[model samples]
Target: MKSYDDKHIKNIVLVGAPKSGKTTLSETMLFEAGIISKRGTIEEKNTVSDYHEIELERGNSVYATLLHTEWKDYKINIIDTPGLEDFIGEVIAAIRVADTAVVLLNAQYGVEVSTEILWEYIDRYRKPTILAVNQLDTELASFTKAVEDARRAFGNNVTLMQYPVNQGPGFNAIIDLLKMTMYRFPKDGGKPEKLPIPEEEREKAEQLHNELVEKAAENDDTLMELYFEKGSLDEDELREGIQKGMLQHQVFPVFCLSARNNMGSGRLMGFIDNVAPAAIDVPAEHTADGKEVAIDPAGPTGIFVFKTLVEPHIGRLSFFKVIAGEVKAGMELTNFANNTTERISQLFIADGKNRNTADRLRAGDIGCTLKLKNTRTNDTLGDKHFPGPIAALEFPSPKVRVAVEPQNKGDDEKLSEVLAEIHLEDPTLLVEFNRELKQVILHGQGELHLLVTKWRLENIYKMPVVFLPARIPYRETIQKPAQASYRHKKQSGGAGQFGEVYLAIEPWYDGMPPYKDHPVRDSEEITLSWGGKLVFNNCIVGGAIDSRFLPAILKGVMEKMQEGPLTGSYVRDIRVSVYDGKMHPVDSNEISFKIAGMMAFRDAFHQAAPQLLEPVYDLEATAPDTMMGDIMSELQSHRSIITGMDAANGNQVIKARIPQAEIDKLFAALRNVTQGKAKIKAEFADYAPVPADLQKKLSENYKETVAV
Candidate 1:
């Protein structure tokens, strides 16, 4: 493979909803660029972008794939990403590094739920984008409606660069607005012949062409003056102005395509080569200290790993973009993450599983290197003397959780090791061993995401795994006040343990007075690790209890707080006033005071109207308005409080406060009800009291466990 300079590179990520023909479009682009001799389809499970075993079985792209093709002087690196929301992490990572985002909209569905979800990230990064309305040959395809949907959802900047002359079954021609020429393709659809606009479509084409000329000229005053003087801009002038608009993120040109038939991919690739912005044309990247750094080929060697793939037998492949300078095969670079040196032993420009060995890759180009010791996603590798380690990529929190366990108890260690490797490959999948719940929790985007992990374990790792419902981390707190005293007496012949404690318990709240009922000698406010506060007040006077025993008393109280009296959950937000107590200097050691404090707190807790609290999450569900009833019903069933509702791109944005216990169920339910058209995001709000009935049932279950 030949090396391409930074100016000749264009990195574009394919993004769309499922069935939008992104994989097919990628295959057509590769075939058009002559990188692939023949085109493949998702139905045949043979496309380079969707080459994973899991993807072959599912017949869609599951991972983001990096493939390069040379068009004229440009080396276009295409990252084909999955459209399903379950694999959003892959799409996000690809968009983070892509210079241009080619957003494909299915002509059948226009802008879909999944596309709306992806548009947020693209808009956030402010990438130069080109919207391609694909699958125009399908029966239900409506090109006009698709353009309207694009303009409405994306913005008015969606310029119509091309439109199909005859859509539906006989779609074989497109009118290019910039060139003012008609592209007539053969029945097989490649290398279209240029022709004059037909008389019937001439007026509309001329009006749209004028609009395109003005849109192109609006970005630059020189282009505007040229447009005014000549009444129109030529192809070269239009390209310069459009490229300027794209670099400013002020224009999103729209094009027509039938990727399955390979109708318009050649023209699309031509525009990407001629008009898309390169790395240096975009904004400078901000460092960890918020310093802007330009992409300098002559500056220093820098490569940032953006994605990691672990094959069954091929080991780990680190995919990275050359940020500055050039990296040659066999060169050594220091890992900014761990300060260790890693040799760039084997470099390849990979398309799917296939590799084209490369001698060196320059700045703004993406390629893969195999077998790095301490490199992973978000890590940077550069020259030893160069400052590097770019800011890390931010991933969304998991929306679904499941408790996973091995079928064979002996495979627990192996399962942990396997899961750790999986996490390295994909950071969105979070794994944790909850000591309080005594369960190994696996958090991911949705059910399919977790099911894929299970499939990998069973098929690739050769391990049997079982998934169970994850336990909720509930809390216990009191609703009222009560008082109790305990006496600990232990006589073991040699020494006797005698201690008595009197304490008043009250429910704690923020900004409350410090117990007017008791005079305090000293106070200690403790912040519990389990998400609440604990306040202990010592009110003993006239040496009713030694001050030295207070620490031991607090320790015993903390131990009890760790396992609350009602349901063995963590207790939070309560105050204990130890106003009176008795202790023997010789017999009453720390142990005796500890025992007395534990029993007294427990006894008072039982009488103080203890309540159970469950975590609450602020959830926002976005979907089409047609599915509003089903969404409302699902939330209502989960006892969610619907806070408000808004409209986003013709879809409903429903916000509510729902219990954490119901969030996992809501995720699956929403997907099924909307047929995977709904997108949801949840963040922890505050903890609220559980329903009375649920509290009673939970208490009974805890009692049964204690008895057993």
Candidate 2:
């Protein structure tokens, strides 16, 4: 294996919407570089990037695949990410380690909804990006419209680097702006023959070329001065200017491509090798403690594991990037997170399912190894002298949730192991077994995301599972104050048990005034684990209740709070004052007091008008303006409170707050209303009181459950 420094390595992540030809382009790149003898199409199910069974079945990329092509003394590591929004976690992992992003656009549809959402992440990181308008050979492929869409979504920095000479159907040539030449490819599309620009296209080519030069020169003062003096820039100067512009996010160079036919991929690779930023060229990585780790092979040996894949027979494969130094096969590195030393038995570069063994991988290079002990997705393994932990990758919060259970019921333990492995691979899918609800909830990016998880559970793990509606984590609390008393007595036993408790229950709120009618002798405000607070006050007058018996009384009240009186939900935000009680000296034990307190609190809760509060979430949905009215109407019917609306990139962005129970309904309606073009993101806000009718129905349901 040949070792290249950080400067000779380029980590390029292929990202776009579905049918943008990312997988096909990946195959073409490998074939062009002679790594593969021939290209494989999606229909053939033999493409190197889409090697997974699930991907081949779906005929699309599902997970982020890692493939490298050694081209022109530079090793370009291409990470082909899924175009579906449900598998966004895969895209996020790929982008974090990538130095440059090649965002492909299907010229037929221009910019898609999924691609726009992914672009937000790329723009947020300010990564050096290249826009490849692929599939120019397809029918209705308009390069002008795609470029227009790019400028609208990505600002004026969308600079045109090449224009298709014959875009639709017979797209065989592209006019290069920087080279001032034309690349005419043969029918097969491997290598292109350099030719002069046709006279008919000379005017448009020169105009776009001048515009590209101006956009590039805006990034650096030196480039600006040179451009003004010479009225144009040479090839080297233009490349330098574009590199600087990409680093600063001042330019997104657009290239014409028909990745299916392999017309312009060779030139695209050449540009990536020369203009794309390498790890050495990108900004230094920051540690958790705010220290910078420069990309240098001579520094401490450090590798950060950004992804983990667990196969049935292969166990776990840890994919990592060498951040600061090189790691050989026999090297021993310590996991900075857990302080455990790990031995590098073997290092291998990955190409989908294929693994090519290598002696070592240098800084900024990505590779994978098997049989790592106690290493996870985000752990940083390095030499013992390496300073500290690297910054962990941030994943988006889950927006959709569903209850899941194994079909066999006996496979519960195995299902747990499967869910754990799933979470290890995709952090966005959260698995939680709710103790109160008695259900296992899987929270994910969307409905499709959960469906994919279910498919995996049934197929890969062989644990057939069924998905149910996730129960809302409702809370119970009183709306008004009420008083009740209870007496617990048992005469059958020797030393009869007898105790009585009198207490007042009222709603609790922040910074509320204390009760003054009976002095609050002592108050302990407790924060409930389920949210909200419970303030227990000991207000005994004339020794009505002994000081020693207060704990017993509080314990009973807490039991009632755990299984709330109204709807059997966790009670929150209520104050309880023990004003008076009676106890028999001979039989007044903790058990007697506990029973009395619980009965009394339950009795008072019914009189105090308890209300059930369901969890609510803040949601923001984006869709084209043509479908905004239909989406808004559907949302309004689901009790969504439309907070605001705005226009972004010629689309409507709707913001609303909705109860958790109605979330599924809103999205189901959106799919039909918008034809699956709407994108939504939701997060937990705060719990609010359910509607009056809903509270009554829920309370009645709890009563029926208790009776049964």
Candidate 3:
């Protein structure tokens, strides 16, 4: 292993939809670079990138894998990412640290749902990208149609650099527009022989070549002027122009390849090594506080941990990118997130499952360190004198939730520890312990996401678990005002308990209540643990009830609020006035007054009209115009109120408010209805009253559970 300067390092990530041949492409690239003797197929489960047991069983990539190869004096680091939407965290992390993204498109299907979804992230990061049309040897492959689809989805910036000559089962040659030559591979598919363009195809090739030159010239003012004077650019000038155009996002070159047969990959690798921008060529990153952090090989050392993996027998493996200066073994750096110092014990460059020991990793290069004490994913480790920490990756919020419980009685503690370890590996898997609902909730992307998590827990951690539907946190509130009085009397042998409470309960709103007639002794506003407010006012006249007893009564009232009278849900938004009460000197203790206050509140709550309030979420669903009617109908069936509708990026944006109860498994249902073309985002809006029939059914169910 050799240490490469920043100019000689090229970091790139492969991204696309599932079954789009990303894994095969990476294997082909590795084989062509002589890193591997033979190409491994996904069906055989021997591909370098898909090495995990779960991935082998599923015949797809479940995690991101790092592989590097030396091509033409450049160390090209390739990050192969998962294409399934459930495992999108892997793709995002890879894109955050890579300099360029190579998005593969299946020629048969063209731009797909997953392709559109990944394009959003690529656009967000403003990455320089190259579109590779893969599976060109398949029966249904069509290069022309694929180009048309890319133009429609991505706009006019898509420029063609290569096109298939005879693209079917016998696909062997591709016309390279940049060099105005034909690369013809043999039937067995090894190195391609460069030849002049045939006479029949010369006219079309020349036209496309001129178009490429024009597109390249548009990227720089000097290039444009030189093109106007000379009417064309030389080969060297064209390569420089294309590189500038790619960095500015003015051109997205499209290349054709058949990854399964290992054809056209060498040309793509050559283009990447010669044209793609290096890590130091891209713009500088910024901190969360808007301070620029340059990628300087001479500056203070800084490393950003983008991914963490937990091996079977080994400890944690932290994958990081050197942002500034160099990292070597036995170097100490400050963890900016926790303000803790950690020592780098060993440095290695990853090649799928294999690792090569390296003496040092320079700036703008990716490598891994073993067993850092406190550093985790998204943490920044740098010199203590650095100004601030680097910006963290913004992950998508969880869309689906399920309540998980241990199969055995005493496995709760073990489950907690295992869940913490899982979170450390993948931060998107959220585990929340809801004390009010008495359940441990696991939130993830979708059903498959949670299913994979459950598999890991049972197989890796040896913990059997059951997943159930999560309970909705419904609330209870009063509708009107009512008055009640209760007297608690106990005649024990030694001491007796005697306390009476008279309280007025009313629905509280924004402004202060009217206590004009009575002089208020104590008044305080409290925020309920559930969702609303509780207003307590003490208007006792002439010490009817002692001032010290007021807090005890409030405490009892709060206890009742935790378990509402109707359905045992948390209660909120009510005002209680201890206007008058009676007490005994010896027996008027906290317990007596507490019981008295509890009884009186229950009596008054029954007198007033009680309502059940359920949580509502603001939902935004983006889908094509053809699916708008069906989506709106589906939302209406779930008791959703359509708030607004607008157009966004050629899709219809539907905004609505839907109840939390109705959103269970909604993501899976939407995927089925829209053919995986729709994306939904939801957040907590507010609490609204549940329908009368639903409220009655919920109350009856609660009572039955309590009785059992």
Evaluated with TM-score, which candidate comes out highest? 1
Q: Deviation in angstroms for 594 in model 1?
A: 0.6
How accurate locally is residue 23 in candidate 2, as Cα lDDT from 0 to 100?
96
Whole-model Cα lDDT of every candidate shown, in order: 0.92, 0.91, 0.90
Instruction: Name the regions of candidate 1 deviating beyond 4 angstroms.
Output: none
Give the better candidate number (1 or 2) by lDDT: 1
lDDT (Cα, tens digit) per residue for candidate 2, span 1-708: 677878899999999998889999999999999889989999999999998778888899888999999999999999999988878888988988899999999999898778898998898778999999999999899999999999888989999899899889988999999998999999988789999999999998889889988988889999999999999998999999999999998889999999889899999999999999998888888788889998888899999998888877888899998998799998999998898989989999888899999999999999999989889888999997787888998888887789998888898888888898899988889999899888999988877788888988888878889999998889999899999999999998688998999999999999999987689999999998999999999999898778999999999999998999878889999999999989887989999999999999999999998888999999999988888889889989999999999998889999999999999768768877876678888888999989999888988998999999
Clashes counted in candidate 1 amount to 0
Q: Cα RMSDs of all predictions? A: 1.5, 1.8, 2.2
**Where does candidate 1 have its weakest 10-residue lDDT segment?**
285-294
Tens digits of per-residue lDDT, candidate 3, 432-451, equal: 99999889999887778899
Clashing pairs in 3: none
Note the clash tally of each candidate. Answer: 0, 0, 0
How does each model score on TM-score? 0.97, 0.96, 0.95
